[model samples]
Target: MKFRYLVAFVSLFHAFSSWASDSFIVKDIRVEGIQRTEAGTVFSYLPVKVGDTLDEEKATEAIKALYATGFFKDVKLKSENGVLIVEVDERPAIAQISINGAKEFEKDKLLEGLKQAGISESRIFSRSLLDRAEQELKRQYISRGKYAVKITTTTTPLERNRVAINFDINEGRTARIKKVSFVGNEKFKDSELRGILVLRKPDLLSWFTKNDQYSKQKLSADLETLRSYYLDRGYLEFNIESTQVSITPDLRDIYITINITEGAQYTVSDIKVAGEPLLPEEEIRKLILLKSGQVFARQKLTESVKLITDRLGDDGYAFANVNAAPELDHENRQAAFTFFIDPGRRVYIRRINITGNDRTRDEVIRREFRQMEGAWHSTKNINISKQRVDRLFFFNSVNVETPAVPNKTDQVDVNVKVEERPTGSIMFGAGYSDRQGIILNGSISQNNIFGTGNFFSLDVNTGAINKTYAASFTNPYFTVNGVSLGFDVYKRDLDTRPLSRVGTFKTETVGAGVRLGIPIAENDIVSLGLAAENTVLGVFADSPQRNKDFVTEFGKSTNNFPLTLSWARDRRDSAIWTTSGTTHRLFGEVSVPGGDLDYYKISYHQKWFYPITDNLTLMLNGEFGYGDGYTGRSLPFFKNFFAGGNNSVRGYDLNSLGPRDDRNLSLGGSKRIVGNIEVLFPVPFMKDDRSLRLSAFLDGGTVFARNIDFNLMRYSAGIALTWVSPMGPLKVSIAEPLNDQPVDRLQAFQFMFGQQF
Candidate 1:
């Protein structure tokens, strides 16, 4: 194509020289040799018009202008009988684009890339563009570690001066890293350094993790990890000199090497503060994590700086800057650091701007903010406000940014952005248990009803042993002072055939309750409720002696009034799949003296989670319960606590771990103690996923009626999988009772879908 253009240029130059002395007046203009292009389009680009005097300069200008449009392949100007004749050859338009054998990327993605490169349907086709598009496709494949990929483009001419372009791609296998080596390491071994990197050599697990595949982005992140490893270990002057990546001849294997300079480790000699201290010197010094004689760590230094900055921010210094300067003493292998603090002008918030919330009301979000408009800006309060909003679970993501107000040096605007998530759910679930047979349950719930931050739920459950229907509603801001009001109504029918030992009986209960919650602190809540229930005991010919005796004593139906008090402190970072923090709950329920069967129940639950690593967490959970009849009466057997099941000792049958009767039916106990230790980790291939979890657990628990027996305790070891799937949350467990006895029943495998864990 370049040669053709060169030849045309030479011919035009010669023609212009021969006609330089000749000039003619153009009577009319006509465009020829155009198939799809209009004559007016040609005239739009031509420099000369009809009835205008034409010369060599004018003719050359017209031809050059026409060629510059890129729509014409050839242009010529000729004069015949005092008329100007313009000739042009239009470029062929693209009719269709098709990509074949493009397994690495979707066809639409590749086509979009071509479209951006000016090679789409209905656009003028150019050979140069085809070559560029081919190169681009190859680049995309190479980024995926497919260095051996081949792309071939073909153009087929069609009718109406249009052509169809096809791209055939052969994406070869991804290149795998065969070896990764490091240099200039004195304190740590190569293995230790490799453990901190994301890119890894080929291993048995590489197929699932894909860590062996070579990617420039992964390599860059790995390098940063390597740098942080050194900096955090007192190698303050460490540097990565260079890195080299080599590929095999077949483009199937990769080798990586990194060169580094490990400087001498330094111990902190002294730490001091510089610049004006807005607060007390003692308070500022307490925020410093670095101390004399300790090993110098860059991470600790950075944390110290952040702490000082945040402290200043809490004092209304929103734009505070704190820098840590280190002075190295090479001779003594010691380092001295000084924190330089810059407490900028104190600023106030002029306005709070909320966006991205299409469903929820502005006040619904504003109520969660601790930082108020027109108040002095406190970074600590701003962060707390964002976290509180996140804990609402009404949005998928919440972000807050502060920008200085225009023309107001001491004022800033707070912008809060949120991405709303689904707040309503309807679920139907089924479960199988050896003792309960098959159980079916369904529920409809909404956390943010009508975007008012209220909650409502209706639940229905049926099983061989129990049937229940319940409804509840809650208003979080009932009194506008962080007080909550909720109401619940339920009806339950229990067939004691499966649970009773000697004989069979049934119990029917209908109840309603109202609860009030008061927030005393950020993480503490106190709740009080009153419930009234009517319970009827049905006695059959085969009823147990205990059931018949209960009916004979208290009559067939009994009315009771129970008052409940609960105090809880929840500090978990996330309500779902929590990785850290502790939760403590204490609950007590007492039947008033006027109740037919006066009884009291007390229970304490504590859960603690410790993050061991980015992908691993250790959780310890414990529960204790005690229930007995008040006013010198025996404890109501119906109010006893039962242990064993998915939420208890999972290896045993549900509610089957306590004492048993002659018929081998489980009898509920008045006292219960259960403890569990779990090591939670990510699923092997989905380590970064937040919605899936795998855990190994050891559970121990026991239920006692009169005397607590340690020998009767049951122990179980199990592995569990928890996934928050689209349908609902799912829990599956496979457990084995470590101390199974003849009387204990086992449900080794248990799975439940569409239920909250």
Candidate 2:
């Protein structure tokens, strides 16, 4: 009321002053009472100029215009010696803003909000804007269910016509939803309906999800979800009549009530394709999800439209539209839907535009595109191209858009934008195991060297049991047809005398190899390689007799040429987080008769991922290996396969499962089998987050020297977590041996970093 009276008094004084002024001609203009605003600024807003006539109306207009600038709190006009004089009291400038007792949000965030509301430092202050900012701050707290929050603002005057503003905030306790009641839900239980809502009463996971908070936006979204739930379950006429939310007197609890009306369930009586589908009627009809006599589902109807539209898009109809028009028979509660398809135009790619590759070359990305410029536009091909680019692991995000070319009905441009991620790293890593104590390794690698899509790496590792140095280089696009060429050189020294789990021996090897990767299919690749190796054996007095005997028979040093062949087909949607797809790998290695050692090894592995729900995935993985000597020679013991580790069978000691020598030491075998089943899901309350995953797994595997025995396999069950952190991939697991004999060595906990297990 006081502020209103002040405004009224100011208006009346301006009116009286304007009516009393006499007509006069202005000689010059002068401004006073301005400390920060320039005198010319005041003159620029005045309606009366030096030569213009000044009258009672002009006096009124000048004052009004000057006040409207928001720079002045008071304005007065007068004339002296035929000169128009303007005096203004400028509004105080804000010198500083400070927030106190703010715990719910960062101070910078709150200050930014105030700035958006025109209440920032160094700006002319307005009482109205200050009040509005205060209210907005309260509203933000309310959104987080803090109903008892309070904010008190203070202004301290300073020299030079500036003021310091401070906000004293008390962010009270956040209220939790005490009850959520439905008034008219009958077909489905209240519990079942509540399960679909994002908001809920406080529960064990509420601390992480914060779903117990009552937010207006969350409620609105929940109501929409409720409407969709009913409509998707054949209740096409469902209506939400009202919603009510109430807070307790103490502001510690909230209650919600939603009233809804569920109409009679409906069934689909018929489905027909009506418009010019551009394709065969049978083919378009086959895409319809609604069948006669089936319950009407809005979700299926929506999916049917999308499927038909996408089918048309695959056929170069970039802007196809599919509308399902429904006719309702109220008495029988049946709906007849006619899908109207309008295949707008057959369009071709006018251009393929690429952007956002700050480091990668344009050719590197363009070569992965399957959809070519000047060809018919294909949505399928564009999507495939996006997947291919994503699989390169060179980018953090890949986005593709097919926008119509202006003024061209039959042409579209494919715009591909990608967010690049760092593809080069120099990492020094360390790992620990019961047997390998602490192993340290370092590598300098670049997957996209100089933006040319080439790979290069130099690695060095030193451990208590082994030491290695290696160099590798690969050109992923060695040819236009997606063939790859790579070369590797490595030297390794291994000594097993310090380990109790294996027959003790020592070996040194130096090798070099070249490989070629040939693309066999869109998802299949075959690689071939050959390496020349020289290995020297060092047998000690305490070494197993088998190792000493082999050294004596084959001599202290031997030369061998080893060949490798591998084929892989990977279709996982994402290499980082796979939800649905299958991956298969088949590998074989042989040291031909020309080498001092004649042996061959072959292995096959398969992984299948299936989505059990939007938030759950079932993964099945199996591996098999068999290696033996050919041409009258024995398989080298050092080349034998080993089981029982984090990568093989969890819950058992590393390399602890296989045939044991007379001294009860592990002798790794010539045959191996491993199987694993896992149910994978994101962490609780983080279903949409892709960087972390948790899984419950069952694992079984064993190694055999000659015969394969199912009963000899070790089994374990456990839960594991994998996080794709900024530093690298981290995996941790806790397992319980399900069927371990007294002879089996058990290891219940394991973890690895820098790479996946």
Candidate 3:
């Protein structure tokens, strides 16, 4: 106790001496710690320089200003050697920022999102800034259901006042949906209504449907779906009143309820077309699908409006407007619908609009456009332009906008804005199959080649059993007259499936083709083309008949006309792997291989896509291909038809679906036909980026030696896995005999890779 009091007495004496004997008066000023900062800045912050009196008020303000610049960590004011001195610690400059454990985002993309948190590539680094960055990182993960994530920063000093920064991150498990409940609708069962909602409950096969995760955003969208479901069946006033969400005690689950109000049902009593017609009234009337005496369906009525407008647009009235409105007789419960149209005067496109092209040049889009200035506008030209844009993988979404000019009558400027998406990249792959054993393949090509928006490709594959090399090119805007040109050169050596003792199947071909394109309508394009080619079929191939007939089938193509009519049926698959439903795509074609003149050929293919859940989808495909001489002559060897393999039956080798001669080389399956089905889901262990997927499938189909009887072909079914990687979608499947064909193993599978289409 005595020592403490003695020490306190000494501290009190010193404190009193310091407070009493303060130094003040005129003094000089000195500044230090100034890198990339001006001395004048430091002097401005000081209330008085060397010749002014030193005081506490001036020192306090000076310190605050110096700190506000965010360039200094420590600021001080003192008198030394009869001069007032200012000292500071400058912030460390940023040398580099490295982020580890990032898969969902690219490095540059991650940096862009981090700028809001006071972190940047070219700025300084601070502990406070790091704390903010950690919070941002946490938020990004939480948004994706990764709530158990951790982020840490490491700062290492470097030369020249700069520091290297590294952020180590651990992204933990993604929260999954436990169950889902829907309430407040008695007309439809819970199961029926849930099917309409894109968000789904977890199932054992949820890996395929990805229906395990619940998102409020998806739920809100489901509510809209519910409303549309009712409205389509005459529930004109159907409404979703509100939605409520509740969280579980564990904070791992969420329950949602949607309250709805279903209005009265009604039948259509009248149909009125209240729009100007650019064509015959009867012609426009024929386009209407809605009729009296039928129930008012929201979808059908909406389609009617679109059809009417599109028909008008085909006639140079590109700005035609059509709207469907329902009038209800409350007492009678009858609804009358009117399609209002304003076929504003026929106008030509003055200039085409192109946007969202960061890497692609303006000429790229302009080159593919079918419509030009000083030409009459037509919806056919507009749609053709859209197809050209769609072929550019550089865009995630493309949209057309036509805003009316208030004073300008009969003319509209077309705006074609696209949401640019990354298209060019490299891919490397390796996979094993029963037939091919182990296959390795890769390719590098630009979909938007040379930024001209023209399609050009040079792809090669050399596997244990398969070798292929191909070069192809396509011009969307081949000429000002609306012609499109395509040409290809290729060679292949394929090992037929079932591993028959027959030697390897080989093909060599070179060709150049031209098509005369003519617009028929908004959704129709007709083309005619001719080609010259030289070909030879190798011996001991899948079928020996190929050599028997091929010597007479090589030479000139007559005309390839109406050769490309693509009909696609699709159900959007939010996830491609582990899929459950089907989307159907059908294409019809007529072409010529090599005949003197006007040779005709035809083909058709149908694909179905069905989704079982958010994570799973089922795809069924059918194709009918054929070619013959128009004047009853021999068809060109290369232009003749054949089908097999992963894209067709999944159990056969590439182009190995026809008859074989005594030596076992394929002649061909001129009237080729095939069908198949597949089920896809997500892969476990791989990060759930959605861009990556895994799947299993069963495919059964066969080529017809004769006409497509639809019943003569064999069937094969089995399973496989897939990965929709960033570079491409890789598919691997195993197939087995379903029809008991004389085989121990229909006993094989195939691998496929597709990037764009």
Q: Which tens-of-lDDT digit does each residue in 1-757 have in candidate 1?
A: 8986787688577546444446899899987889988888888988888788998778888878887787877676767788787767788999998889988788998889988888899888888788888888898899878999988888999998889988888898889898899888888999999998989987888888878988889999999889888888788889999999999999999999999999988899998888877888889889999889988878888888889888888777888989888888999999998888889899899999999999988988999888999898988899989998998899999989999989988899999999999999998877654456777889999999989999999999888778899999999889878899999999999886775342467789999999999999988999999989999888887665776788889999999889999999999988887989999999999997777988899999999999999888999999999999867887766777888878899888777888776667676889999999999998998777889999999999979978998898999999999989876677888999999899887889977664455
What C-alpha lDDT do the candidate models reach, one value each?
Answer: 0.86, 0.89, 0.64
**Full ranking by TM-score:** 2, 1, 3
Better of 2 and 3 by TM-score: 2
Order the candidate numbers by lDDT, best to worst: 2, 1, 3
Candidate 2 segments whose C-alpha is farther than 4 A from its true place: 1-9, 12-21, 43-53, 56-58, 685-689
Cα lDDT of model 2 by residue, 1-757, tens digit: 7986789478649744744657877889888789999887877787888888888777877777877899988887777888777777889999999999999999999999999999998999999899999999999998888899999999999999999999999898999999899998889989998999999999999998889998888999999999889888899899999999998999999999999999999999988888889889889888888899999889899999989988998888888889999999999999999999889889899999999999999999999999999998888899989988988899999999988899998999999999999999999887655555677878999999999999999998777677899999999889999899999999999888767667888889999999999999999999999999999989888777888889989998989899999999998877878999999999999996688999999999999999999889999999999999988887898888989878889898878898888877787899999999999999987777799999999999999998898999999999999888765677788999999998877889987665435
The parts of candidate 1 lying over 4 Å away from their true place are 1-29, 39-68, 79-84, 422-438, 496-505, 539-544
Worst 10 residues of 3 by lDDT: 554-563
Please give each candidate's TM-score. 0.93, 0.94, 0.59
Best by lDDT: 2
What is the C-alpha RMSD, rounded to one decimal, of candidate 3? Answer: 9.7
What global local distance difference test value does model 1 have?
0.86
Q: Write the per-residue lDDT of candidate 3 for residues 330-423, one digit (tens) a residue.
A: 8888988787779878876667778888878887777667777657777777777777777656788888766655677766677889888766
**Maximum-TM-score candidate:** 2
lDDT of 3 at 203: 63
User: At residue 74, what lDDT does model 3 achieve?
Assistant: 62
